[model samples]
Structures are given as C-alpha cells and as structure tokens.
Target chain A: MLKDMKELFKEQWEHHNLIFRMAKFEVKGMYQIHYLGSIWQFINPIIQVGIYFVVFGIGLRGGRPIDGDIPFLLWLLMGLIPWFFISPTMVQGSNSIYQKVNLVSKMNFPVSLLPTIRIVGNSFQFLALLVVLFIITLLYGIFPSVQLLQLPYYLLSMYMFLFAFTIWSSTIATLIRDYQNLLQSMMRMILYLSPILWDPMGDRVPDWLGNILKLNPFYYIIEGIRSSFLGGDWFFEDPIYLLYFWTLTFIMLYFGSRMHFRFRKDFVDYL
Target chain B: MAKVEFKNVSKVYDMYAKQSDKLLDLLSIRSKKSTKQFWALRDISFEVNDGETIGIVGLNGSGKSTISNILAQVIQPSSGEVTINGVTSLIAISAGLNNNLNGYENIDLKCMMHGLTVEEIEAVKPSIIDFADIGEHINQPVKNYSSGMRSRLGFAIAVHTDPDILIIDEALSVGDSTFANKCLLKMEEFKQQGKTIFFISHSAKQMKTFCDRVLWVHYGRLKNFGAKKRVLGNYVEFTEWFDQLSEEEKKKYKQNMLRKQYTVQEKTKRKQADKKNKWTAFGHLAMFIPLLVLGALIVLGY
Candidate 1:
C-alpha cells in the first residue's frame, strides 16, 4: 500500500505540470476567438457580479445588511468569491472527462489529469475574482490581519476538497452521462443550499438541519474562509472537523484514482 | 526497447438497445429480445518486439481497430493481459483531436495528453507548428480545417512526441500524396530510432513498403502472422476469392447477414428484395415491425 501510494503520488506530480499547461492553454484558447480576447475573462465575471449585486443585493432586498455584521453586498461578494471558485470548478470538472473523451482514449497518459486541468482553469478564474475581492475589501476598510496569514492553509484545504470532488465527479460522469446534468442541478441547489448568500447562524434553523448543512464539505470551506477574512472564530478549529474533511478528501481521491485507472483502458471503446 | 504482448486476450462487448426496446421486450415477455454479447476479439495473442513495423490488413469489422486499440492501451482485453515496456502513442489522428480547439491549442493539449510538461510543450510547440504547415489557420479551430489539415496536424504532433510505440489507424490516408510521403518518412525515422509501430492501412502497396511483418485478420480471427510478403500475399488471395463470388452468391451472403442481424420475418423480406435494392429491403423491413405486429395479431385472433 505504501509503495502504491508513492507511485500514485509520483504519477500525480508528473501529470500535474501537464494539467497546468493544458488548463492555461484552454483558458487562453477560449479568449483567442473573441475580438475582446483575454479582457473578457475579467469583464465577464465583473458583469456577472454587477448583475448579482443589482438583482440579489438591491432589487431583492439582499442589499440590506444581514447578521448585523458585514454589509449585504460585502457578504455576498465574500461568498461569491468562493462559490465562483467552487461552482465552475465542480461543474466543469464533472464534465471534463466526457468533454475530453478523445484525449482520454487515444493517449496513454493518466486520465485524472483532464479533470485536474479543469480545476486548475477554474482556480485561475478564482484568482481573478480574488483580486476583485481584495479591491472591494480594501474599499470597505476590512484590512487583512495576522489571521490572513492562515489564508493559504484555508485555500489549500479548499483546493484539496475541490480536487477530490472534481475527480469523483469526472469519473462518475464518464460511466453515467446523466451525472453531468445531475451535477449542474446539484451545483444550482448548493448555491442556495450552502451558506453562500445567507448565514445559517442568522436564520436560526433547527439543530438537525444545521447539522446536515455542516455535512457539506463546501460549508466547511466557506466557513473556513469567512473565519479568516471576516474575523469570525475558526469554525474548523476542532481538529476533528479538519480530520473529517481531510479523511473524506482522501477517500474521494482514492476512489477517483481507482475509477480512472480502472476505466481508462475501456474509455475509447465507449467513446 | 519497447515491446507489446497480448497474452490470451479477448474482448466481449455487451450490446444493449435503447430503453424503448427494453420496454417492448418486457411487454412481449421474450428472452430473445434482451441484450446480446458480441466478442469483437477472442483468445487473440501476439507480441511485437522493439523497432518492428507490423502492418495489420483486414476487411471492415475484422477487429483491426480493436487490436490497435488494445495495443495502444486504449481498451483492455476482457480476459488476459497486455503488457507494454514503453510509452505508447495511438495516432488516431481525428479521433483524439478536439475540433473546437485551434491548431496551436490542440497541439499543446496533445502534448499535455502525451505527458509533456508545460516547458517541454512550449519548447516543442514551434517545431510542431512548423511541421503542420497549416499557416495562420493554426490559430483557427480544428473543426474548420480540411481532413488533410487535421491529419497533418495530428501526424506532426504524434511524430514530435517521439513515442516509443506509435500506433497508426488509417490516419495517413486522409492526407494528400505529398503529406503521406512525409508521414511515411517520419515513420521510417521512428523505425530507425527503434520504435515499435503498429500500422493499419488498406493500401497494400504502402504496407508492403513500410512494414517488416504483416498480421492478417479476418472476421476477428488471425489468419496469418508472418513475413509481410507471404502473409499479405495469402490475405490478397483470400480477398480475391471473396470478390469473385457471383451476384447470386453475394445476395445469399447479404441475406445471411440480414438473418443474423434482424428477426425472422424481417429476414425473409430482406432476402426477397436482395436482388433489386438491398437498401429498399432495409427501408421496408424498418416499417415492417408495426405492420407485422398488426398482421400477426389478426392472424392469431388476438
């Protein structure tokens, strides 16, 4: 088992750099066709944020402050930043294998690399949104603290979780194409279900409901980020939750790797 | 040196019809209406040593692609195993390429797919671009490319990867004579470099020139695997006999195929119309299902 783990890790490392390059190429390729080009990456998301701020923040009265802490706009932006990272990462990642059926079948390389590329691409978009988040936070006078140093750890946790989920979804989607549609629906549900736009603490829901909400890995990630930036106490302070998150991530990673390795050989036949 | 071995390998495909067929089959309560198993390849075994250029020649549906796929590790044998000593690249030119991606991005993606790092891809990108020779259209989507352009780009990328085992599946035929010659030269260079090549092509002349050995497959069975001249000559003889069949014999052959493919009643109509137009028979048989159900019900007093 130790030897297997070592081999898997080595393979992952070798493929990771390739994934990164492909991801960058995909993002660049997307921009190449349009007249506006790479500017659209910045422009497109800003437009989306602007529309959300106007509709959800102002029009739907989401603009009003919630939890008597962060402004509604600021709260929405905070959640949106992570969601921006999570949703696209998951959705695109889920469909990544199916979309690249051609590459998966003909190439002898690891199939896990394709979904990794999708996650990496989404992460770049997340970084762009992070810039926007920083600008907004600076304007609001919510400056970074020593706790902000912990941002990398939180981001690492989020990355691990997203990677695990992407792998799981990519593998599952290859077997059952309906899983892609299911993923889109689930992501849409999670957008509202998770405490992205609303604070579960403020809503005062039943204990069982809140407990169930905690079961969501994204909930922990979002809470972890909120704790770091918003000065909220560490929601994941309990070593148990950290262990639980990591354990689940590892399990998913194992299953994902197994699925990719097992089914990869027959993918061309199906495709 | 790269070597590939398929030991006692077999592949069986479980053929399942759509949901409607299942529902109808269930309603009819017939076991015959259920799924079927097709063995595309069975108990096939072969080994190709390093630097051996083996040509595979076979009629359509003779498991040529299946064998190539297995060698490329694109598909596993249902039974037994395939072991490879080095990196294998399958030049399924059109199949592996993303039509939506431009030529440059496609090459980059292909490089990445072949397990090249970013820096490595960047370094080799210029050579791939120059070799493809598609001009500025390299920035355009590959879907817009003609078949020749796609083949050129694919061949260029595959050649640049420097694979230890290169498997080509009828991709060379897409390009013009000039480009095809370039591809052949590249294959020759790969052979000189001691790379294992499994080439599948219908062109007997090309295969004779390039391959040191030949594997002839017929109806998913290996007919011969030996020296190119001997095996290919035998394969040509077999095809010649098939081609010499009379029109009546051809009709009987097609009818036999239809019987194996369709239900009993559909087979009769297909056999009857085989002489006139086989396609018309298929059209009639396609519509015969509903009409047959009605006729059978009336005759049986259902």
Candidate 2:
C-alpha cells in the first residue's frame, strides 16, 4: 500500500503539466454550458457577496463592523472568498471522479489528476476573486500592506488542506452514495462554525471557546487572509496554530491518500 | 518473447442483491449473507509476442469483451497478473472522447494525456486531420459528430500516437466504406511497423484476413489459442457440433459450461438466515423503546 501510494505521487508528479491543462479544459467546460459564459464566474460571486453582506451585515449586525473598524463587508469577504473557494472545490472535487469518467475512461491518464483538476480549475476563479478582494479592500480605505505578501502561502496551505478533504470525500463518496449529500449539508453547517459571519476575535465569543474555534483548520486559513486584509499579525507570529494545522492536515492527507489508493481499483465496479 | 502476457488471470465479479449488499459485505469482516460470485474469466492465460496480429473470436456471452477490457486495463483481474511490455492504446466505440470539447481540442487533450507535448501533437495533427477527413466539423463538439465521425476521429488520434500495442474492438465497423478502407491500410502499415495488435471481431472473414493467430474463447475459458488455421479449424468444428445438438441439449450444454455459483438449496438457506438476522436487528431496536420507557417510569416514581 505504501509503495502504491508512492507510485501514485510519482505518477501525479510526472503528469503535472497534463493535469494543469486538463484543469484549464474543465474550467472552460464549466463556463461553456452557460449562455453568459465566463462572466458568470464574477457575477455569481458578486451576487453571493451582495446577499451575504445584506443578510449578516445589515439585517443581523445592524451594518456595524464585526471586527473593530474593519467594515463588515471586508471582514465578511475575507471569510466568504476562502469559503467560496473551499466549498466548491470540496463539492466539485468530490464529484470530479464521476464527472471526468467520460474523459478518462477511454484514454490513459493519471486518475489522481481528476480531484486536483477541480482544485486547479477553482484556483483560476479564486485568483479572479482575489482581484475582487483587493478592489473591495480599496473601497474600505484599506491600503495594501506588506503582510499581503504571505497571501500565496496561505493560498497554497489552504488548497493543500482542502485538497486532502476533497480527495477523501471523492473516494468515500463513491463507496457510500449518501456521502455526497452528507457533505453538502455538512458544508452548510461548517460555513456557520467557520467564524465567517461571526468574529471569533471579538468580545462576543469567550476567550476559551474562541481559542478552541481558532483550532479549526478553516479558521487558520480565514484568519490568515483576514490578517493580510486588515494588516494584523504575520501568519507565523503564532507558530502553534501553524504547527497544529499542519499536523491535522498531514494526518488527513495521509488518510485521504490511503483511502484513494484502496478504493481506486474498485471504482469501475462501483460506478 | 512475449510483449503481452496473462498468467492464469481470473476476474470474478460479485453479483449482489443490491448496492447496499456490496457495502455491507465490505464493512463486515465476515459476511453472514453470501454474494453470488460470477467468474467473468476463469483461470485464463495467454501470451502474444511483438508484431503479432491476434484475433479474439467467441460466441456471445463468452467473456471476449471481458478479456479485451482487462487487456486495456479498464478492469482488473481478481486473481493472477497481466504484464505488457509497452504502452497499449484502446480504441473502442466510446474511446474516452469528451463530448463537450471539439474534435481538434480533444486530439490535443488526449495526446497530452498520453504524455505528448504540444510540438508532438502539432507534428501529428495534419495527418490525423487528413485521416479523419471530417473537414470543418473538426472544430465542432464531438457530441455533434455522428458515430462514424467519432470513430474516425478516435481511430485517427489512436493510430497516430505511435503506441507499442493496439487493441481495437468492433469500433471500426461504424464508419463508411471509404474510411474503413483507409483504416484497413493504416492497420496494415501498423503491422508493417511491427506493433502488436489485438483485434476482436464477430466476422471470421476479418479474422482470417488479418490475424496471424486466433484465440477461441468459450464461456470464459480459452478453448483454443494457436496459429490461424488450427484454432479456426477447432472453432468451426465446435460450432458445427453445437449446431447438431437439439434445443434441450444446447440449453444443457450452456448451463454446464456456465454453472450457477449457488445452488437453489443454498440460496433458500441464505434467505432463511437473512430473515432471522433481520428479526434479531428489529428485536434489538424494538426492545430499546420499552427499556427506555421502563427506566423513565422508575425515575418518575411510577
């Protein structure tokens, strides 16, 4: 099993260019279905941001800033953008194996590329939204800070974390048909717990509870982005969260990989 | 001497009552309810050397497709192993073409997947285009293409990629006569280039025209695998003898060849045990409600 996992990694490495191009095609394929096409990528996120800002920012919080002086919209977006990237990647990546079956079943390609293609496809959209993030920050009168340089690192780590969950969910979802539905509902709940709408750093949350919530792997990525936007602590300032997050992420990654290797041969039978 | 080899490979698929049965069987360390195991191919072994043209011939439901699918690595064997010396390209009816993408883009996409670079694909694109001869429709989505056009495009991409082994299964028959002639010439060229080919067809004429050796598979077993004349001779004799058998005799012959995995008595025993197991499960849940009620009554001083 260990050797097989190593072979998988090697195959993935050797086919990195092919995976990247296929991801480009996948993203193209997604927009190809829509009449408005690639414009919807921006429009859909804008609409999501609009509804979220109105609901949580105006209706619930009375348009008041959740994090002191950081506008509710900016704070919400810092969380929402990452949430947007993570949620879709997880959902779509889980379905990637089934969705790409036609493209792959006839030809020879690295099957590992299927899940990662979702990630790569989503990353292009995520980068586009990052531009929206900067535009949103500028509107809030927040100047670009040097801490923003660490954005790529946070993006990398966050994708790694989500990619682990994505492949894990994809593999398990194939075995148990209900797992896909379960993940859909779970992602909805996770959105609330992820400190997106509510600020964990605020006085509203108890320090002990807030500290535990910070231990959530999503919170680490969200807070990292927040720190970049609001110009707060550098990511590594608190090394324990970084260490804790990596430890959890690595365990999940290994477990996810093991599940993929075991179930991969049996996928045709199940499908 | 062997470019492709199978060492006693057998693929047994578990025929389940439902999808959940598979899940249950996987979860349980020891299954209480047995699954019916159907051996798609049983203890089959064969070898084909470089530059050989082998035809797989069999009657319907004789595991010919299963063997080809295994060779193409679409499905794996339940036991034993398959060793292929070099890359094998499978060109079937579907041939893994993404329907959403245009024919031209798909060519690049599939070639890239096969580890060809842009330069390599560009070098081969004109010939694939020439062979397929679909003209401006090459830019159209593959879904829009006719089955013949799809096969043409698939064949064009597959043969042009320069694979060491080629497996073609009933795919080329969909095209027009002209395209079929073109494909035949291309296949002849491949043979001249000394590549191994596994061609499967129902028509004995095609087999006789192309194959250096013929494998006659009957009911998942290799009835014969030898040179063109011998296996074909045996297959002809078998068919003649089978044709002579009466209706009842033929049915019995089939049943004997493909035996039932479980007897009727064993099936009924399993059904009875399943009923008992379900009762115990319901009993556990049914007992829980009253036990909870009794505990509640005691706690409330009833």
Candidate 3:
C-alpha cells in the first residue's frame, strides 16, 4: 500500500507539468461556449453568495451579525467561498476519471493525475474568490494582521483534504456510478450539516451535537478558513481535529492509490 | 535487439451480468458469480526485432485489436507476460483525439501528454499540421471533421511523436489513397531508422509490400507467424477457402472454434483456483481486520 502511494506520488511529480497544463485548459474549456467566457467563473459564484446571503443572513438571521461584530454576509462569504470550491470540485473531481478515461485510454499517460487536474482546475476559481474575500474584509475594516498569515496554511489544508477525498471518490465513482449520485446527495446533506449557512458554534445548537458535526473533515476546512479571516483560534489549538483530519486524509490517499494502481490498466475495460 | 516480445500472453474479459458484481469481484467480497469469460487472446506468443514491421492479419472477431491494445499497453494481459523495450504509440481510427478540441489543440494536447516540452511541441507543430493536410479545418473542432480527416490528424500526430514502437490498427483504412501512401512512406522512413512497427490491416497486398513478416491469427490463437510470403500465402488461401464454404458450414466452423476458445482453459483454471482458495481466506482476514478497526475509529468520533 505504501509502495503504491509512493509510486503514484512519483508519477504525479514527474507529470506535474502535464497536470498543470491540462488544468489550465480545463478552466478555459469550462466556459468556452459562453459569451463572457471565463468571467462567468467569478459571476456565478458571486450570485450564489448573494442568494445564500439573502436567504440565510437576511431572511433567517434577520440581517444580524454572526458571533459579535462579524456581519453575517462577511462571515457567510468566508465559509461559502471555500464551500463553493469544495462542492463543485467534489462532483467534478469524482467524475473526472470516468469522463477522461476514454479520451486518454489509448495513450501511456498517468491516470492518477485526472483527479488532481480537476482539483487544481477548480482552485483557480477558489483563489479568485479568496481575493474578493480579502478585499471585502478590508472594506469591512478588518485590518490584515498576524492571523492572516495562517491563510496559506488553511489553503494547503483545504487542497490536501480535497485531493484525498477526490482520489478516493473518483475511484469508487468510476467503478460504481451509483456512488456518484449518492455523493451528490451527500454533498447537499453536508452543506447543511457543516457550519456554512448557520452557526453550529452559536447559542441555539447543543455543544455535544456541534462537536459531533465538527468531526467532519470539511468542518475543519470551513471553520479553519473562517477562523483565519475572522480572527479565531489557530488550527494548532484544535489538536484533536487536526490529527483526525490528517489521519483521515492519509488513509484515504493510501487506499485510493492502492485501488487506482490496481485497476488503472483495466479502466478501459470497465468503460 | 528484440524490441517487443510476448510469452504466452492471454487476455480474458469477464462479462458481468450486473455492474455491481464487478465491484464485488474487484473487492473479493464475493467468491464466485455466474460470470462468463471471453478469452480474447489465448496463449499467443511472438517477438519482433528492432526495425521489423510485422503485419497482423486476422478476420473480424479474431482478437486482432486486442493484440494491438495489449502491445500498446492500453490493456494488460490476464496471464503470462509481455516485454516492450521502448516507448509505444498506437494509431487506431480516430484514437485519443478529444472531439471538443480543435485540430491544432489536439496536436498540442497529445504531444504534451507524450511528455514533449512546449518548445518541442512548437517545433513539431507545423510539420504535423502540414502532414495532416486538413487545411482550414485545423481550427475547427475535431467533432466537425470527417472520419478521414480525423484519422489523418491521428496518424499525423502519432508519427510526429516519434515513438520507438508504432502500432497502426486500421487507421489507414479510413483515409484517402494519397494520404495512405504518404503514411506508408513515413513508415518506410521509420523502418530505416530502426523503429519497430506493428501494422494491422486487411489489405494483404500492402502487407506483402511492406512487412518483413506476417502474423495470422485465427479466433484468438496464433495460426502462423513466419516469413511474409509464407504466412500471407497461407492466410490468403485460408480466407479464399473459408469464403467458399456454405453458410451453414461457416456458422458451424465459427461455433466450434469459439467453443474451443471458451473451454480449453477451464480445467487448468479450476485447479489454480483450488490452490488459491486457502490463501484467499487468509487474505480476506487481513483486509477485513483493518477495515473493522477503521470503522471502529470512525464510529468513535475519530
């Protein structure tokens, strides 16, 4: 299992150029038919944030601030930005292998890079949204401080978690397409379950229940991103969650790679 | 040096009644199911030296494409082994071109996937375009191109990559005679450069003109692999004879061959399975134990 993971890592390292080039093309290809081309990448997410802001911040929360002085829109945007990246990436990355297998089957290309390509492709939009979030934070008078340096750490954490989940999910989805549908519904459930729309750290939710929900690795990411921007505890302060997240990610990576290498040559047969 | 060798290589494709059964079989959760195995290639062995252009001639359903796919490393053999010494590129009809991408983008995409640097791709880009000869259609999406144009671009890209082993699987059948002749000249140049090529085509006369040897496959088995004249002569005569048989007789002949392909390996496979049963039980435990522990951890709030 370790050997398989190492082999996949080596292949990814060797073909990193191909992965990046294909990712760039993927982002370009996404909106090639639209009149605005790539500009929709920004517009679509902003529209989603607007909808959630109205529904959750105004309609539900009475346009009130989250926690103390953090306006609901700013707080929601922080969590939703990463959620927007994570959600579509979950669907697209899971489908990447099944979609590209036929196109690349005749070549000697590394199949493991397909999921990575999706993850990286989706990151372009995620990074753009992060820039918007930063400028919004300044507009709201939240000055850049030492807490902002942790943004990179949280960003890396998000990528690692996405990589692990996508690799594993893509393998299962390719083998059993029903899993893809199941994953779609599960992402919807996760959106509600995570502290994205509502505050699990608020007064209404029970402490034990909130702790249970925090067990989700995505909670670590959504919360980590919010905390980095909103000035909360560092990731290291939550040692148990940090340990749990890394453990889960590595386990997924190990198994994902094992299954990936075992069935790569047979992927064409399946399709 | 022998650039390609196959030692008793065979490929078995299992026909699963339900897709879920495939997942179960992959995970070894189910010991056996009512699976039907189709042996595409059975115990076939051959070797090719550098610079040798071997023609693969077989009737439809004789597993000709299966052999080419295995040779190109697109699929793995079910048993035995194959050794390929250098980079391989396969050019089937419209193989590996993204339909949504334009012709020029397909060139860069394929070349990049083959590990060429950007500068290298740029250097070869013009020649590939010139050779494809699709003109202004190069800017149009590949989906809009005709089959002939698609194959033209496919052949152009495959040759430009300059693989050490090239397998052409009926890619020439879809192109115009002029383009086919152009490909043949380029293949002749490759032969002079000591590259091994596997040519699979129905045109016996072309095979005779170009190939150093011919491999005649009959229903997944190697009927003969020898000098060009001898094997092609035998194959041409066999096809002529088979073509003259009554329709019923032809049906009977095919049924008999396919039955043999299915049943020949059953006894050996069973014996091997019996031997494997013991280790498989232990293997199940090894996998199950870790999964059980992992489940416990997840349930315990990680």
- Which candidate number has the best TM-score? 3
Error of 2 at A197 (Å): 2.9
Q: What is the TM-score of chain B alone in each candidate?
A: 0.77, 0.81, 0.87
lDDT of 3: 0.86
Specify the CAPRI tier of model 2.
incorrect
Q: Give the clash count for each candidate.
A: 1, 0, 0
> lDDT, candidate 2, residue B214?
97
In the range B227-274, model 1's lDDT, one tens digit per residue, is 999999998887788789998997787566434433222111213445
Q: Pairs clashing in candidate 3?
A: none
* Candidate 1: regions farther than 4 A off: A1-8, A60-62, A203-208, A235-244, B18-35, B98-102, B116-130, B192-194, B246-248, B251-302
Residue B102 displacement (Å), model 2: 0.9
Candidate 3 residue-wise lDDT, B38-157, digit = tens = 888999999889889999999998999999999988888999889999999989985668776788888888888887889999999999999999999999888899989998998999
lDDT of 2 by residue, A51-80 (tens): 988988899889888655778888888899
Write one digit per residue (lDDT tens) for candidate 2, span B1-302.
79999999988877777777778767754355455778778889999999999999998888888888888787788899899898888888776777888888889888887778889999999989998999999988888988888989988998888898999888777888798778878889999999999998877777888899999988888889999888888887888899999999999998887784222212224234577778866764664554445434433434
Task: For candidate 1, write residues A33-103 as lDDT tens digits.
Answer: 68898887678667777887888778876467877757888887788788877888888888887787666
Model 3 docking grade: acceptable
C-alpha lDDT of all candidate models, in order: 0.76, 0.81, 0.86
Q: What's the lDDT for residue B38 in model 2? A: 83
Estimated TM-score for each candidate: 0.82, 0.87, 0.92
